[model samples]
Target: MTTYSTGGEAVVEALKTHGLTTVFGLPGVQNDWLYNAFYDARDRFRVIHTRHEQGAGYMALGHTLATGKPSVCNVVPGPGALNAGAALATAYGLNAKMLFLTGQIPQKMIGREMGTLHEVPDQPGTLRSLTKHYDRITHPAEAGAKIAAAVRAMNTGRPRPAALEVPMDVLQQRAPIPAQAPVSEPEEEPVDAEGIDRAVSVLAGARRPMIFVANGAQDVPEEVTRLAELLQAPVVGYRTGRGIVDSRHPLSCFLPEARPLWDETDVIIALGASARSALQGWGKGGRSLIRIDVDNTVHGRYGQPEVAITGRLESHLPLFIAELEKKGIRGEDLAEVMPAIHADWKERSSVLDQQIRYLAVIREALGEDGIFVDELTQIGFASRILLPVHRPRTFLSTGYMGTLGYGFPTALGAKVAKPDTRVLSVTGDGGFMFAATELATAVQHGIGLVTVLFNNSQYGNVQQMQRDLYGGKVIATDLQNPDFERFVTSFGAHYGRASSPEELAPRLEEAFESGLPAVVEVVVGDMISVDRFR
Candidate 1:
């Protein structure tokens, strides 16, 4: 049976087939047909209208991160596409699966440069640089297949963002609507026997073996935990690696405590994580490294690994854990060592009275199940070590991209995805202003998001850099912030202020309990600077 449909209708059907029930986008003239298609099927699809294209992209990313599924973000051609670049790049850096759909000029006038509205000389090429895969729909009939291909690319192997562009005329044209079905991800590659043997041998021989888990291994929490328990290895998580293991576990250690152990440990098992700067080039010199990753290109990029297992952690970790048990290798429990390490960190962290106090309040306020979205702030950098995350995907950040202005929008998306769960966006004064307009989006949708704005009136990170490196000669870092109370209230949301550390907890508690979109601004002075984890 054949059915006639416009390219826009085909896209809507494809999204439904892909199990996408919600999408984030802003309707515009160039993409009116697609919006019309969505309007016709509004009962079946929930479209979140964002204030900006960047917000739409971040919302898609937040939804995907929370649910472990891909979502769509639709934007007009050229400028809107460019505006979405930051969130798309952040998604790429975080290895998130997102489908970015954009409107393109009519196929007939695509490259003629006849001043068509919303035209870019090479739109697809620009998007190619930002996404894992890029495709353009030239005809209405191709929409379903191209969308399927994009979804496949998003789900297979190491997931990343993918983009598709549809021309205006093509979206309006009628063609046969192909039947679509759910796209299945490719099977995880079988664990290599030789690599497993090599890894097991190293673990068995080493007296002190440490496990370094990264965000890539987030899916295999059980396997990761079992492997750690079998070896009794101290596990260090960085970036997305947080909450892979319970922070309160006896063997769980953060980067600060694990840094010294890097020198003492005879063998290091690097799982689904890179030996990046955050690890301080751990695998470089004297340490023996056994690395397991889905991307083989990372092998030997930082340092040569004794065994490079090229397979998903979910597939290879269980095999390695079983082999370790077969060889009668068991790790010594670090029950005593872990407590002392945690105590020392606590004492040192206490020295930064204001920062630690603020973090403690927020941590207590959010409780165990609450989600924390961090932007690039002094508090954000500190929270990576101080905050305790207990579940996968609970802590969302810009990751390696270190993108500012990511917290609020991403938190909005997370709230949309997990409406029942408490979600908070923690940002600095400078970063908060970037996406502050999102308050309208939240209030309009009745998303009761609590934003904790740490207002120091400066780009604290860069200001500290100049002060330390250039003898206190600060340049363009100071900021004049708006009256947050008035700003948020204007959106019909509540607002509160805390000038000192003692006031934060109560204000945060009140704001969160209000069940409205709110901002709690904390005014910390220049004395609150970034402190290194010693």
Candidate 2:
């Protein structure tokens, strides 16, 4: 069935076919026709208009990170696209599934550099650099195919962002909709038998094995847990990889807690984890490495693994477990010794007393199912090792990108994805100001995101670095912030204040109880830095 429709209508249809009903975007003249189409189909779609392009991009990223499903982000040309570049780059680093849509100058005006509206020297080049797949829809007839191709690019292969650029003229033009079926996400690759055999041979003989997991292993928590139990190996995750195996599990360990064990381990199973710092920084200590991942390029990228299996862990782990079962091979369970290790770790990490105390309050308030978004703040730094994440995707970080100011907006998107679950963003005074305007977006959309703003009135991390490393000379680190209560209340959002962890707990409880977009400000003085642990 073919029907005449505008390019914008075709693009929206392509997105709807993929079951993407929500769009995080900021409309402009270049995307006027697209917004018009969105308005026409208002009942079928929910457009979360943002105050800035970066907010739109990060929110889309948050949605995907929380749900492990692709989301859409639409922006205007040139500056709009450039503003969202950081989020796109972060998405690329984190392997997020995001489809980026942007408008171009008039098709005829492109490449001529006629000083036209929203023109840049080479916009397509920018998009190509940030995304794994990018294309331009030259005509109205190409809109559907281009959008569909972008979706396929994101869903298949190494799960990165994809982009498409459409000219305003093309968006306004009408053409017959092509008869095309919706693209299905490709299946995870089958296991490599030879690779699996080599891995099993190494694992069956090893007395002490360890498992390291990252974002790639997030979906196969049960499989990873089973494999870890079979080997009686401790599973360790850092940052974005947290909660793959519940922190409460005896076999589960945080990055810092696994450091001492790394010395005793003879074999390591790097499951969908880069283990870059462990292999490169910590030195392997002659451990036999076995890596299982979907991206084959990681085989020798960090260090040459003794055995490398390229496939999804969900497909490869069961085979390893079955092979170990056949051999009747099982390592000593660490449950008996884990309690002592946990106590020692707690005593050793007391240097971070303030951070741990604050985090405890937050953890209690957030509960088990809530999502916690981390920022590049001092507390956020400690959280990588100090926080106990009980479920997958419950802790969202910027991965290796270490992006600042992504927490609040990303938390909004997480709340949008799981409205019934509590979502909290932990940010510093300096970082929260970046996307603070998104408070309006939350209030207007009724997002119900609760933000915990740690107000030290300075970029605490940078100041500490400057004082310790640069001989007590600090510049451009001190921040003069507004009265947070007034600032938040002015936007018609709820606000609470706390000066200590004891006070923060009740404040957070009240904020959550309100069931509205709220900001809880925590006032603190200078505290110890956690850089040594990192």
Candidate 3:
């Protein structure tokens, strides 16, 4: 710990209370006081420096998601926070829990005539818009209570995220330490028996049912599987819940297929999910939506439920299963609906399999220890179609906030976070290029990640629409290749491009075997063409 001062001690104490092991971000003058605080507490805490603030925020996010616990990030204000805004937005968008810490210029000099040095007008105000909870420490004396409020907020009603900002001067002052722990994490309400019965009644009554989950509920696949078995509902994750269960599971009907689903379905239950519009199926007047989530913010108006139960997913689900069994809602038979859905999906899967054999070959060659990272484009759908994600934590994707450029940085973080695993970034050409510059960060940092850039060249999703609706005329759907493999070589990361499935498989094999940073570019054509195109 390179820190000092009573305020600094307060921050350290707060982190210790939270059991935070690592802090990701570079030390800067603005954050000097906080760094000094860390220096002082170095024996109990450790800091992991990142090259970019975005990377640091993302690294902390990856750590939080992987470990299922909150992670800490220390960033300087201005560009540091701005650069990290995307990751913060992602955290909010994903319902991920984290603490974003930033050091401020002295509070007295906040908005003065001399331009406040590195201060950018409204610092905490700017952050407050994106975060669920954020506040600045006005005085050293208020540190304990403020930090406790932030921590308590993280455990309460709806945990988007919390931010605690301390000014340089504020961090240097001596403050009274609280004797007792500030805030305790809130406990979930036990799954109510009445609520369970109500949920099952709705499910049992529905002729056509669909379960759209948003979070990675698959961590307890058996429980989820049990529920699905009881209802015989077609299970699918709108976006975040993509790989909750094996997409290839015979019982589940949804994948990242392009065509519309849930159209014929009359009932939808959203559990531990952020019930977005896309998944809800707009204008479906008759479809009833049943939601169960720990976060109360998911429901509108107030923390009320619409045929819902509120609590942690892990704890509540088993009880739900027990209740369903107790009520004698034994088995469901959607035999007719199941066959048609299966046939429609199978037809599409067969067509897709013919084209993307490369993804499977690559997975096989990389072996069981391989780790897969997915981007938002067809890379996500394609991987779902081509690869078999057999185990948990072996695969990671932005299920909540599916964004581009998330792949490379997240892969690097995952690699560094779990060095023993073989990490692979499966992303579209456009998405891959978003953080392509980070290849230098990867190589320079000496982290080895195998990047499989799905080179459809243009924004694959947009091109597919144009190809289907228009006459396949290449409008904005074209790219000037920069010899990606060689282009990234300057960054000390190896590259290999493949135009065919045969070519991609061998290249991925060699790259994974090398135990170094490498890129394998695969031209899979417009995979969406498979989605919309006959």
The numbered model that scores best in lDDT is: 2
Tens-place lDDT per residue, model 2, 1-534, is: 888989888888878888889999999998998998999989999999999999999999999999999988899999999999899999999999989899999999999978999999899899888899999987767777777788888877678999899899988999998865678667667778888889888877798898889999889999999888888999989997899999998888888888778778999889999988677768887899999988899989988899988887777888888888888889887877678778778888999999999999999998998899999998888899999999999999999998899888888888989999999999999999999999999999999999999999999999988999999999999999999999999989999999999999999999999988999999988889877765
Residue 331 lDDT in model 3?
48
lDDT of 3 by residue, 182-266 (tens): 4765756666667777877876667666676655364576777778778777776544565566555655644444224556666
The list of candidate 1 runs beyond 4 A from truth reads: 278-283
lDDT per prediction? 0.84, 0.89, 0.70
Tell me model 3's lDDT, rounded to 2 decimals: 0.70
Which TM-score value belongs to model 3?
0.84
TM-score of each: 0.96, 0.98, 0.84
Task: Name the TM-score of candidate 1.
Answer: 0.96
- Each prediction's RMSD over C-alphas, in Å, is 1.6, 1.1, 4.1
Listed per model in order, the count of residue pairs whose N, CA or C atoms clash below 3 Å is 1, 0, 14
Backbone clashes (count) for model 1 = 1
